[model samples]
Target: MTNISNAKIAILATNGFEKSELFEPRKQLMEAGAKVTIISLESGSIKSWDQKDWGESIGVDMIVDNASESDFDALVLPGGQMNPDILRAEDKAVDFVKAFFDAGKPIAAICHAPWLLIEADLVQDRNVTGYKSIKTDLINAGARFEDSEVVVDNGLITSRHPGDLDAFSAKIIEEVKEGIHKRMQKAA
Candidate 1:
């Protein structure tokens, strides 16, 4: 196995991201010695959605339009109703997710974050799990949805909710240590 200290991971998000979904995994990954960058729609900070109200804000490390899949070892997408909903609508955000997928880089998406995967058309023919509310959407988008703490197909890792953050974050670190998955397929 490779060392996690050398890994560089990216967490993509925006306003309304689930506070715990983003913070927990980030904290775990960082504690494990990986370099994590928070990518967002803008350069400043992005607000998070906790349970019912707006939560904390995290500084953005790089804007989506300026980030490339090649710069990081893996990608993470945190979920919240508005975060993925808003990101999925942005061409730049969708393209960025698609690029990482095309490159076969490790990607861990949790809860509503799978919406971004669907927007990038990366869930088709894949096994995934996300927040219960988006299960039908995953099925409609051509994915075999699994109700589990975590589901990983190739390098794509997904989990249902914040409760699965431990598995989600661990899988991301493991995948990165293994390097890019040798997954081959037609473009999305």
Candidate 2:
């Protein structure tokens, strides 16, 4: 079983988020005993984009302006064409992502979601993976792009597409647990 019970994760997304990317990871993380919070641009609910139709509605636990990096243990960015596209346009959301990286916390970004990482300038000199189309942009931003189901560099975890959910979620969970173990060892 997963052992991240004390881990608190922040999932950043907004309207147009890929349906499964947000839901699947949230479900798995919660099941693993991690406390997950959905942080978005606004309160209320955010919509999602399923394969060909509109998907589920996820509640926002807190707005970007009110969120603090100290409250969470990790960050998860879910991708959909419009989701990250819209989020990158918001200065607060962009800064939120930047803060998480600045804190040296584990981050998981999949699909087109890595756009925020690019916007936050956190992709520099790191190895990552994302949708095929954005691979060029990530490379240009100083990320060593790789074509893989899942790529974990340090504490940054990334995946190619929605099809890689299994690998992506697994890697994120492992990294989170590993991070906890490392932190505990340091404290010891």
lDDT of 2 by residue, 1-188 (tens): 57679889999999999999999999889888899999999899999999888999989999999999889988999999999999999999999887777677888999999999899887877889999999999999989999999998778899989899988888888988776322111122
Kindly list the per-residue Cα lDDT of model 1 for residues 20-129, writing each as its tens digit.
99999989998889899999998999999999999999999999888999998899999999999999999999999988888889999999999999999888889999
Give candidate 2 misplaced runs (Cα > 4 Å).
180-188
Model 1: residue 92 alpha-carbon error in angstroms: 0.7
Candidate 2 colliding pairs: none
The number of the candidate with the highest TM-score is 1
User: Using Cα atoms with residue i matched to residue i, what is each candidate's TM-score against the true structure?
Assistant: 0.96, 0.93
Superposed by TM-score, candidate 2 places the C-alpha of residue 162 at a distance from the truth, in angstroms, of 1.3
lDDT of each: 0.91, 0.89
Candidate 1 Cα errors over 4 Å, as ranges = 1-3
Clashes of each: 0, 0
